[model samples]
Target: MRRVLDLAWLALLVFMAATWQFMPDLVGAPQQAMPRDQHMAVMLAVAVFGVWLTTRGALLVARLAPGLVNLPCRDHWLAPERREQTLADLGDRLAVLGLGLVLLFAGLHYRALQAAQPSWPQVPDIAWTAGGVALGLIFALWLLALMRRFGRLAPVTTPRPVRRSSRSRDLVWREVQPVWPLLVVLLPIGVGVGLGLFFRKADDHEAWLLTALPLLLTAALGRMVTEVHGDRLTWRFGWLPWPRWQVDLDEIVTAEPARSRWIEGWGIHVTSDGRLYNASGTQAVRLTLRDGRRLRLGTGEPRELLQLLKSRIAGD
Candidate 1:
């Protein structure tokens, strides 16, 4: 289902490119004496450029480090040393992902400047280029907040609650288990490339091709830096330095699986009163609060993990 949504997003970008290409009059009447053919050519060129940008983005996401993708999930994998390593690995991935998002917006801003057209209506250019950068930043911050909520930044030395039971104890959930949904970035690129090839309205395929490249590349790089571990109910997308979040059991309200057609593209949802942890599908355990409100439990669900949490919380 997630893949399907990605494909849909890709189609939207391709359609945008195609529409921009075939219909020049739609954008605006040619200001200069540039021939209609030249105007069409330029529009086509931009469409291609858009495709490239979209593709580049996807490629960046896919190329994240291998260790993030290959973290062990079995019980033995949870040895103290391994746990420490997981924490370290996750922190690095988050930092990297955060930095990557910042860079992405910066690059978008730069491109917007290069794309500025004084003679043409400034609104559309600003809307596309500058507005895009703004939106990207907003999205990045939103993602960062998610990391924070997951308790990614808490100091390791912070005093922790005492677990009286020796048989079972609360597992501190830190880094996001590396998951591969980052591949979704490719959806837009695929659509751009596919449309460019199939939609023969334009004489030049270069237009669509150009637009797909950059988006795919960027997506790949971003993917490479992170992975969501459905088993661990965590995501690892940082770089070499950064604290990984470790969501404590007390803060979690309810952890239940959820689905969404839009927001998450399809995964789990962890909500706390339909607010704070209100993230959409990504495979979450809904943490039910004392007020009956819910929060998110990251990606993984061990055998009877929810039962264990409930029993533990009840005792508390």
Candidate 2:
């Protein structure tokens, strides 16, 4: 499929070049007489330019400075060991996008070129509008694949919880695993609402893409868990390990319930107080490191977690 796309892209480029040079000739008759819409012509040109700029520009950035490429789990991908492999992988994915756009625009241009000698046909405005929707869907799928692939930052031999012995166990707490019932019920409704809100006469079906957010959020954080194994305090959302956090309990100077304004929103974010790692609610346990930097961990049992943290920091 990929190779076929590459061949099609090459052929389309040749065809477009031919049309560009000999637009006055070699064109056939139109199916119907419609006035040439200047506005539509300009919009199509702009759309083509935009695609070239984005896809080709990304390819340029990858070649010159690979570090600038924003990647999920960037620390691992940009590391000296995996840098080349990461760049090559990303470049290929981007090429796929460029190919798709070329194929897409070429088809629209060809359809417009038909039935109009010396000038392009008066194609319906809806043709390019539909093309734009397809373009958006392609971009969304590209992003999903990129995130899912680079998001796994865990090492091959990464350790997990084993049989707990008296000396090994300190604390183990599971806050909440996202409920399938809740999502299964709420997602379709959310999507329906989103489509209702953002739907446009111009065929803007982009709102449906918003549904991917909740799905990704749930996949990323299926469960919220925190544990203290000896001196290290660790926490992670669900089974994904890249976004894990670890704190040195001995270095903690204070532990308390966190305070947050409504503006902070959710997820991992930096705030005036510190960094917040929240999955759902605003409730969290705040810890202040000796260096004055603070961090908050969202928790359901804040009182017990706070007490345990205080005792650990106090050398109990």
Candidate 3:
């Protein structure tokens, strides 16, 4: 859904370049209606699809979960302490974006309606031209602003990090190799195949949806990664926006490897000991925090991750 809608908008912007070749009138005022489907598609794409970033990029499940909002620097803004504000702002941004969408479609819709009659004052082609651009900008800017604000935010408890050489900085980074539990990965594929077989006659969108679900799930569950940078630790299901987390390096009191029980299962779970961030398999490194909070960080390379933690904390 997100990809298709974005492609729809991309088509108009890319085609808008044709103003030089054909619709040159697009640039100036007395700004005329984009005669064909260009304007219509922009409005539809932005209004229908630009609902403050789907996959908030359309919640690709972003609104469904803010921690996993698909930002590489998610740890900075989506920290547990500030999460509520994020949800509130996300709601507000979407509400305002809704208004913008209303105006956007209204202008484009009016232009379409008036395209036939010359006497109808041309609705300034701004709607067809800059409307979508502005709305999309709003989406991008909101997130950029969020990341900007939080990235610079001084932690109340954590101390600031000092400068380090490139080599030393690299030492602080570790990849918690993600693995696919064969059964978990195959379950979706199996379901999708059964659905396809059952619904062999399903239409294009339905078929796409059926096929897409397993593929998406497979991708989301396929990889897990963890990293430490700038005195912060971050991790995610490789390539996904949710089911990820970050922590200030200063918060940790100790780090060590632990064996996850079969009963613990996988994914994010709150156990009696602490919250668990598991990708797959039984291997994980448990971190004891200054606040006495515990986290079982799932990793394929526990030694490297443990070393990375030591390097970061020791400021090596």
Query: Would you list the C-alpha lDDT of every candidate in the order shown?
Result: 0.41, 0.62, 0.60
Q: By TM-score, is 1 or 3 better?
A: 3
TM-score of each: 0.33, 0.40, 0.44
Worst 10 residues of 2 by lDDT: 158-167
| Stretches of model 2 off by over 4 angstroms after superposition | 1-171, 177-214
Q: What is the lDDT of residue 189 in candidate 1?
A: 63
Off by over 4 Å in 3: 1-172, 182-199, 203-206, 241-243
Question: Which 10 residues in a row give candidate 1 its minimum summed lDDT?
Answer: 223-232
What is candidate 3's lDDT per residue for 107-210, written digit by digit as tens? 54455445554443454676567867877886676556445434454334454344444433233566755556633656467567757755776455445555
Residue-by-residue lDDT tens digits, candidate 2, 1-316: 2343456566765676565533433333455433445424443565556555656677577557767878788777767776676766666667667777776677666565654443323445697688788888877867776776688773443233332233344555445535344356556666666667565522233354455555655666656667866566887775655456677666677788886655876565556565687656667888876544578887767887887777755566
